[model samples]
Target: MDITVAEALVRCLEQEKVEIVFGYPGGAILPVYDALNHTSIRHILVRHEQGAAHAADGYARVTGKVGVCMATSGPGATNLVTGIANAYMDSIPMIIITGQVATSQVGTDAFQEVDITGITLPITKHNFLVKDPAKLPVIVKKAFLIAATGRPGPVLIDLPKDIAQARIKFKYPKTVELTGYKPTYRGHPSMVQQAAGLIMSSERPVIYAGGGVRISNAAPELLQLAETISAPVTHTLMGLGCFPGNHPLFLGMLGLHGTRYANQAVTECDCLIAVGARFDDRVVTKVSGFAPSAKIIHIDIDPAEIGKNVRINLPIVGDVKNVLGAILPLLKKKENGAWVARVQQLKKDYALRYDRGGMLKPQYVLEKLNEFKDDDAIVVTDVGQHQMWAALYMRFKEPRSFLSSGGLGAMGFCLPAAVGAKLGAPHRTVIVVIGDGGIQMTMQELGTAAEQKLPLKIFVLNNQRLGMVRQLQEFYCEKRYFGVDFQFNLDFTALGRLYGMEGYTVETEEQLLEILPRVLTSPEGVIVNCIVDPEENVYPMVLNGSPINEAID
Candidate 1:
């Protein structure tokens, strides 16, 4: 049976078992949207193309699938850039479909035409411009395969208007074959043995885990490795929920805005086993001083990242889970009692602290939120002080429970992401913690949530300032305090009401305590506008050029 290329595209999505697609319609993409009307795959209509991309990103993170998002040409396709970059930076698997101008109009700059594939080249794992209608199914198959494979990232497919309208006999490819793109899954036995020997020999060792742990589903293996060797574990921001936050051996997040103790442990450890983590500048503070005493062993699927930032004493290029599994058995159990005692002492001495007696603080709100929410609740945050506070305060016991814009640090991520997360994991509670500035960036997404009737518990930490940048100014610019403060802050609770959701504003601990329980247990969506102190800043911050351990509160 011959079908329009647009129909064939839908069939390809069905073949891939795609349950939901987040998108916005426009003229260039009309045929695909029309064909989608006949499918069982749920299509979430977002107000903006960026929201659609972020929604798909959130869905992918929570569900461990290739999230799909679509948009039309020109501004519509360009608007998806930030979200695509966010997914690329975090290693999230996503398929971005964009509609281009007709094939004949290529290079003519026809109405609503743009070179989306060219613009997204550096940010995507792979991308295709579909000029041939017969190749749409194969392109989609390859896109999915590339996006969801080892060291996952976003892949794009740009369908010209004419290509979508063209007729083709539908045949979704069952397998994909792409040359020069094989991913290594198994570590060499000799390298694994050497890593085990190093682990067995070192008296003070620390496991530095990152987002790859979650991507590779290596948390169980990581936990076993840490326990068997009795090594303290410190995580990168993207790695928060990969290990149980409450575990005794868990040193909280390490590096900028990291726990002082986690940073200190890394500084003093004799061996640093970096699993699936790139040594980003934020995490490595001053590379010369970072893990100065440790011999570094890096395990990652991407070989380019092994020695790209920090010098690695040993590099094991393979899947995190596979590498850790191989290294686990070659090691003997250790009782590094003195090192364990030292780490425990550090944890106690440098525990996160904030003033609780003063006016509302973001940290206090997050601590209380942690106490009130279910252990399995999914917490998604936009970047800023509120994001750091959430990372420091929340306790996550499972992978994918904590989602944030880690690498890109994109603002305006929380609301739309929460919408996608709730849709992806409807059975689980989804919460959004974002700052006033970030919420305003994508607050329009509230309409999408309302239409979907998603019961998302949103908390806007209303600081009335770009809090993170304001803190930076205080530290580096003699407190000039330029351009960061919001002279007129929106009433978030009132804004929620406009979207047909209940809303509340809390300015004090008493008010917060009063409102938290009710809002948390509510069956309908609700937003709590938390008026946090503007002067409060995320602490244990590493000063520029200083080692991670030498942080100031």
Candidate 2:
């Protein structure tokens, strides 16, 4: 039976069991929008295209699926760039569908037309431009398959208006056969054995976990291996929630804003097992000097990332879940309790603790939030001081309860991400913690939240400055504030009212104590404008370009 390409596209998505979609309609996308009304898939209309993309990311992070988002060409597609790049850096699975101008008007720069395929080439794992209606099903199927497979990333499909309107036979293939798209799933047995051998021989061993553990759902395997070998575990920004934060075997996060004890443990270990993580500069300040005394065993799904940054003594290329599964059986079962004890002592000595200096601290805010909410609630954050605060303070009891822009560290991720997260899990409490600067970047999403009636709680840390940059300037620039001072005075209450949201600002700890409870109980989403100390810095920060241990508090 012949059908419109638009019908085939929606049918394919339905076949794949896509329940939620985030998108914005436009002139070039009218045909697809028309088809959208015929499908049972729930569509969220975001106020801005960027919100749609971030919402998709949030959904994918929580559900462990390829998040789907749609937008029109030109400015609409370009707006999604930040969110797509954010997902790419974090290895999140995302499938983006954008509507382009008619085939004849592509290069002529027709109204609301842009070359999104070219713009997103480097960032996406793979992309396709569907000028032919017959290719729609194959391209979409392949795109989702590529996005959700090993070493996940975003995939884009640009459909011309003519193609969407054209008629074609609809056949949703259950399996896709793409010669150029096979992902590495099994680890080399020899390489896995070599890594196990190193673990057996080393006196002081540590496992540095990253976002890959969560992406591959290898947290259980990782915990089991760490327990069997008695090795201390340290995490990158994205590695949180993979291991329990309060676990004695877990040595908190490591990086520019990493805890002092975690950094010291990484620097002092004799052998390092890097699992599902890239040695980005943020984590390894001095690339050459990082783990100078340790033999590095790198395991990842993508072969290109094996030695791209830090040199690996043993490299295992495969899916993290698969690699960890294979290596567990080969590992020589032994206990190194002394090494684990040593890390525990380090953590106790240099524990992350802060005093509530009369002002409402972001840490206190997160803690109180936890006290009020359940484990099923989802937490999202934008990058900066607030991001670190959420990581350090928020306790994620479940695997997929936390979402943020870990790799890209994008500023305006929280608000839009919460929109998607709420759509994915409507019954769960979705909270967004963002710095003032980051919040302002995409504050327009408040309109989307209001319109969709998504119960998303947003906490804005109104410090009146870029707190993270100011921290850097204070340590490295001899306390020179420079361009870091942001004087924009935004009235959160007024802004929330403008977007038809309930807003409250807490300047003192007592105010927080009184207002937070009320907001938590409110059925409609609420906003907390938390006033914090602008001069405060994220402690135990590894100075830029220096080793993790060389940090200034």
Model 1 per-residue lDDT tens digits across residues 224-247: 999999999999989999999989
- Residue pairs clashing in model 2 are none
**Candidate 2 off by > 4 Å:** 498-500
- For model 1 the local lDDT of residue 498 reads 94
- Best candidate (score: lDDT): 1
Task: Indicate the TM-score of model 1.
Answer: 0.99
Model 1 CA lDDT for position 395: 85
**lDDT per prediction?**
0.93, 0.86
Encode model 2's per-residue lDDT on 128-168: one tens digit a residue: 99988988998898989899887899999999999999999
